[model samples]
Each structure stands twice: as C-alpha cells, then as structure tokens.
Target: MKIVIISLLAISLHLTNSQITSGIVSDFVRTNLIGYPLIHEPKTWIFDPDVALKRRKQFVDLHGDKGEKLIERLGLGIDGNYEERLAEQRKRDEGHLGGLNAHLP
Candidate 1:
C-alpha cells in the first residue's frame, strides 16, 4: 500500500511538472508573438498570435531596442517594417509556388 501511494505520487508529480513546463513555454511564446510571426518564429503551434499580441506592450517596454533587434534577428518583427518585408517575401513565395506547381506530378 505504501509503495502504491509513492508510485502514484511520483507519477502525478511527473505529469504536473510536464504541464508546468509546457505552460511556461506557452507563456514565453505567447508574450513574444509580434516579434515572431508566421515565418519568423514558426512556433505558432506553441504560441498563438492572440496571446502574443495581448502582451505586446509589456514585451516592448521590457525588452526595448535590444528586444526589437533580437526579434528582427530571429526573423520576427519590430513593427511596420517587418510587415512590409513580409509582404514582399510573400509575393516572392507565391512566385516560387507557382513555378513549383508547374512541375508537380
């Protein structure tokens, strides 16, 4: 009976720890969305844009220019400039997609 209880407690702790770790990861990603958009972060699966945008102001204030540069380096964005660049990239992507489709089996 004692052994069974200890095993259960250990299993519960393992599961709880996993959940906590994932939660922190989610929060981190959520808070950094704008800095890392669809192509940039590519961790949309982990951090949705909504959650990220929700904390945008806080993130900017905390990280400032250094943060902005980090996001840019990560392929994310600082703001309007990123959008413009992304738009241009999308156009280029579409052109490439069109070429690839032409050769598809």
Candidate 2:
C-alpha cells in the first residue's frame, strides 16, 4: 500500500510538472509571435518575413537539424526551405510592385 501511494504521488508530480512546462513554452512562443498587446490589438511585431527568417536561421544554428524538425512539427509552413520561400515571396512582391509602377506613370 505504501509503494502504491508513493507511485501515485510521483506520477502526479510528474504530470503537474509536464503541464506547467508545456504552458510556459506555449506562452513564450505566443508572446514572441504576437507581442504583449495581443489581447488588445494583436500586434504581430515578430511576424514579419525578415524577422521570421532571421529567427529561423538563429534557431537552426542553435538546435541544428532538430530545430528544423521542430519547426516542421509546429506546422508553421516552413518546411526547411526558408530561402526558397523568401525568394519566391520577393519575386512575387517585386512583380506586383512592377505592375503598379507600370500603371502609375
């Protein structure tokens, strides 16, 4: 009976710790992505493409391949081809701006 009680107590503590850690990590990620005033205005300061690319590079440098896998698991649409995505976005934006310029003058 004592062994069983000890086991249950350990399991409860482990579960509580896991929950707390998960909550902290979720909050940190949300704060980094959305900024502090998320409840009021939802300002996405770190949501810019350049900022995201920089952060991605830093993450990859710090965590190596595991970082890439983590990013993939996060379902952020970054499938380890950040450069390709950035290039594509740049081309698209330039094309759009070029079209606008053509029509302006």
Candidate 3:
C-alpha cells in the first residue's frame, strides 16, 4: 500500500513538473519566437474607433439632459463651447438608425 501511494505521488509530481515546463516554454515562444501575444500588442487601442463612439452615444442617449448637466458639474467646460458639444451629441443621437419602419414613415 505504501509503495502504491509513493508511485502515485511520483507520477503526479512528474505531470505537474511537465505542465509547468510546457507552460513556460509556450509563453517564451509566443512572446519571443512567434512575434507577440495578443495581450502585449500595442495597436489594440487604434483598432476600433467606431465602437467607442457608439458606446459614448449610448451613454449620452440614456442620460439625456441630466447627463449633460452632470458633465457641466465635472467642471470640464468653464470657458469652452459646452453648448456646441451638446448640440453635436444631440445630432448624433437623432441620426442613429432605429427600425425598418423608419424608412417607411
């Protein structure tokens, strides 16, 4: 019984060691040999601008005037054209394509 337990433990240790070594080797190859891993790439920021704009549009749409008022509270536009930005947001909100019936009406 003791011999069986010891054998099982030795096998488990071998497997765990192999797994750790394989993980280290794969990570090294991915970063150094295979150009780069996806998480380490720099161009991730510039890949999708429209998705970001769409998210901002959704936020302004949901919060409405209350949202604009909150932006003013944040003291972002003490002298700059806040009203112009608000108008631009309004235009964007209105221009979003809603439904198939929109074209018919």
Candidate 4:
C-alpha cells in the first residue's frame, strides 16, 4: 500500500511538472513567434494594427531590442525597415499574380 501511494505521488508530480513545462513553452512561442511577427509587420495579418504595434512597443520596453537583434541574426531583415520589405513583397506578389491574370479573359 505504501509503495502504491509513493508511485502515485511520483506520477502526479511528473504530470504536474509536464503541464508547467508545456505552459512555459506555449507562452514562449506565442510571445516570440506569433507576437513578434504581428508586431514586426502588422500589415500582413488582419488583426488591429495598432494592437500589434502597441504589443511590440511593450515587448521592446521589456526586452530592450533583443527581439530586433534576434530578427537580424535570423537574416529576416532589419527591424525598422518592415515597410520597405513589405512593399517589396507586395510588388513581388503582384508580379506573380499579374502573369496569372494575363491567362484569364
């Protein structure tokens, strides 16, 4: 009986720890991956641009430009030049779509 109780307690603790670890990982991804992109280029997503910008500002205020440095390290482009890159992406997208339009009536 004592052995069974100890095993059950161990199992419970393991499960609890797993839950905490998973929560931390999810929060990390949400903040770093989803939040960062939304903040970096609000034009791409349909969410309120102001909210993204505000969250980005909050992140910067907290993290002190680490996000921008990470983006640069990843070779994604500079932080402040999102508009230029976005415009270039739009032009590239339009160019690809333009060829398809020529095929239609």
Best by TM-score: 3
Clashes of each: 0, 0, 0, 0
lDDT of 4 by residue, 6-96 (tens): 7556655676587775666566667855785657764655667588777887888665576754553344465777777767756666845
Please estimate how well model 1 matches the true structure, expressed as its whole-model Cα lDDT.
0.61
How does model 3 score by TM-score? 0.22
Model 2 over residues 1-105: C-alpha lDDT tens digits? 686557556655676687875665556546864666647674555456687667876788766756655653454355687767656656666846633755566
Please give each candidate's TM-score.
0.21, 0.21, 0.22, 0.20
| Best of the two (3, 4) by TM-score | 3
Give the residue spans of candidate 3 off by over 4 A. 1-16, 37-105
Ten residues in a row with the worst lDDT in model 1?
35-44
Instruction: List model 1 lDDT by residue over 19-65, tens digit each.
Output: 77566555555565434354565443565769877888887777674
Clashing pairs in 1: none
Predictions ranked by TM-score, top down?
3, 1, 2, 4
Count clashing pairs, candidate 4: 0
CA deviation > 4 Å runs, candidate 4: 1-16, 36-105
Q: RMSD of each candidate?
A: 20.1, 20.1, 16.5, 18.5
lDDT by residue (tens digit), candidate 3, 15-99: 6687775676566557766766676666635577588667886777765644855664454465677778667656665745542
Off by over 4 Å in 1: 1-73, 98-105
What's the C-alpha lDDT at position 79 in model 2?
Answer: 68
